[model samples]
Target: MGNCCVAGASSDMATFKWSIDNFSSLLDKGEGWTNSRVFKIMGHAWHLKLNPMDRNSCDEECVSLRLQLSKTSVEPNTIVDASFRLIIYDQLYGKDSEHHVSHTFQTASTSSGKSCMIKLAALKNSSGFLVNNNCVFGVKFIKVVTTKAKTTSEKLFVKNASTLPEAKAAYTWCIADFFGMENPGYSPEFTAGGYKWSIRLDKEENHISLYLKKMINDLPEDSAVLVEFTLSIKNQEGGKHLKKKGLTQFSNNDPTWGWEKVVSMEDIQDSSNGYLIKTKCCIEAEVTTVGSSKMK
Candidate 1:
């Protein structure tokens, strides 16, 4: 910024008017002598430079004026996309000479940030400039905004997830506890896929049998929840564990879903195998659910 005055603003865009009472003496100060002010527009700080005398790219006989964005005010990309209109008021004729611009403005190294609408010559008795030693200018910025919408077409949203140790579901039944059973089977309810779920041992069957169950009422038509998981019997000796991969879904009539017979009782009861350890066994499920809903 050079020699200039900062004043109060009016209306939407910023406006500046300067009256050089000693116009002849100001121009004589030097060619590089500029009158500039640091102003804010569109939430960004900028400099409005008015060079009465000629500068590098400006002609000797013309008055050079332009706008520049301050370095600290720009975003990280070092580029600004904007649309603006600059105005130069010819005070002598009461008509404004305006230039409209809309483009992507780059950083300081790529551009000088100079937007000059006009270069008023020092013409005596001219209608284009210098009305009683007064000059006026204005700048207006146009803003852009964006919005998002939903579609009916199915969209897949995937995320990586894991279960915490504190939330793990495990249960062990002794021989006496198994014989004195009251319900259909032994089961422990847990939470997964943002809903209540459980893994159960099929009590009515004589052989090795289990199933996964989801507790939920009827959902909206075309809305479904599919859960894929691996249920494994934890091993103590670090040998390969007995694991079964299964997938289940939530529907109106049937919520309990899983394989009817996954393993045989003979293989599971073998003490040498890792499935039964110290008369205690454990079960773990790694679950991932994908829910789809029809968009209206």
Candidate 2:
């Protein structure tokens, strides 16, 4: 029989070493047993078992190694998900042999490991494995997965889900250097109901792109607002303005909504249309309806 020394133990990983002091005697006597001390990891206790001459193997030269839960430390009906590595160290050479596997331990007796870790003949033949009368076997817990089951439910009851009141507002922004400005332009922030809003303007392939953005930094998670609005490019020469109407829901994930082609670039470039004049342009947003929610 041999003894094991627990090197270190942690929540996610642990290591231990088993030493056979009299290697020649174990090989000659055969059928020897060894086990390690209890080691706790992630609130679970574990230990290792080694057999010098595995009775379960057809080949007499083979050995068996297993990782088991400490029966005294485990609770009834407890389950553990884990992965580990069994290692045979070479004392002389740096070449080490290892076997890795995963298992689900459902009971106190349930164990996970290799039945045939290595052959005793190979261990004796290798110079690095067996030095003098000493041999080393090791185990490393690579992962320990813990699962928690929670049970609960929540519901928000609104007295009138479809009859909430609507709010309306409008804002207009003027850009002095329209032609010399950047590709994307932003309007000043405005308040509408409980939320702040802004307008974004960009140049799309030969057209103008406009979007309405809902500021969500101050809002709580899962908050959403339904809005109906109009985006327009004002005709600087006092002609009819070009406009697009839209209706959409605004949430954290989808904070902005708009059209890529609100008005063609040809219309703005043409002097006869009067959409742009003296390097200046105007943009307007009319939030016609904003649906809000009330919590009880």
Candidate 3:
């Protein structure tokens, strides 16, 4: 059982748009502002605020727009580094109005935008902006910095194996009380590549975390083992088995490597999924030691 895919970090831009119909009706509602349906960008919830009339006395002839981060979505004191563009589409003609902002949003600076987005007279002029009582607005997120920082240990694990060994071994562990099992359940030690190895499962709140651990003791300092492996949970009733693959180095200082969420507990608990049958389940690991070395 050596199976799982290599994992890494990624950062990509994201976008969102909002459209409103009956544009003229919003002005008659007497409400100073209205909000768009909530949407998400990289897991953070946000929404657009459209004010029919500008908030400032000097900009009364213009409409204002703002991008607001959802209070319930972000934690207190958390900071979000963001860059985005706000757009007001010209429905009839193709001339769109745009505004761009790059700022770190926090507790006090959760909203950002332009106070004078478009002139009320020009928007209602029956030209490009408002057509057939319809209007459109959009936001494109240029960046959203995540809080989690990748660790040096993960970098050491993703390196490609210098050489490949045809040798590989697979082992399976069966559990009697699947859900009732304590935090970590270890598989019997199995031999692979002249080293004893075992599978470890920690029952987390939402996932069954999996890890491949070396079970040997040695004297060599600065020693490391290059391994390629896959960890999986079998579907007892003939369903597709959940599996993941990984390639990493196992050293004296770091004897284990695997995913924090190999398979979710939700999938394991569903009876029809066949992951658990009569309170019993199976876990497997396929391991291969491509190479190993010791510091000179």
Candidate 4:
């Protein structure tokens, strides 16, 4: 016997070739014996059997071939899905004779393999298949790949943040105070995505910093949340806003995210920039957060 391998685009495909000597004598075995070989492909074992002629089936001119997967090591009677093809190659002229019948193997099947037959007279009458008493046979099995549907989380907040149902005063800092402030102030709290969130204005020199805080008051220990949001410094005079978008996970110890300098102190104080409306500034946030056990 001879062996050969064929490569396909996906690493999943397995192709095998077998050569036979004294080809005519093997066919004379009839139903008494079948020429078969066990081979591994796509992580499973399969059987390929060939009969030279079907003289017992009232058709001496026909030949038979079978392709079957070995009993699996998986659970008893496990359903193994597969797709494959079997061919009796005509090596003399390089023309491969496709049996052209059925070759699909699936889970819902009652059997594990497929069998095909062709007229020996047609094969011989063609060319190159049975030459010098030697012939080649081959089988190709395809790998099936499956993927799950992707899921995404989303949220919406009322335009009036002051009336937000789960909101608390996330943070407040004396706008003009800088030197003595070392930490974020008390924040306004709200819930989105499966976690509590807060917004804080940190007092910093020359700039007003902001942050979204993960509220831990009622949170379970080691809790984590995935947060996605867009924060904007809305210009009350004009709509040319300063905006930022981000996605990150917030854990108990690191629950905040925001701009360190939302707008420069110089930009904030500029009258023509639409940033200060009679000394009052406008801030806006659109957020979506979720409870996530795995992150990528």
The TM-scores of all predictions, comma-separated, are: 0.38, 0.45, 0.44, 0.40
Clash counts for all predictions: 0, 0, 14, 11
> Rank order by lDDT, top first?
3, 2, 4, 1
Q: Of 1 and 4, which scores higher on lDDT?
A: 4
As a whole number from 0 to 100, the lDDT of residue 72 in candidate 3 is 72
lDDT of each: 0.55, 0.75, 0.75, 0.59
The runs of at least 3 residues in candidate 4 whose Cα sits more than 4 Å from the true structure, single-residue gaps closed, are 1-10, 32-35, 55-60, 72-74, 100-117, 144-296
The number of clashing residue pairs in model 4 is: 11
lDDT of 3 at 6: 12
- The per-residue C-alpha lDDT of model 3 at residue 264 equals 78
Provide the lDDT at 234 for model 3.
Answer: 87
Q: What tens-digit string does per-residue lDDT give for candidate 4 at 95-150?
A: 77554334334334423333445577775565588777777777766653223334
Ranking, TM-score, top scorer first = 2, 3, 4, 1
Candidate 2 lDDT, 249-278, residue by residue in tens: 677778899998777888888888777887
Score residue 36 of candidate 4 by CA lDDT: 57
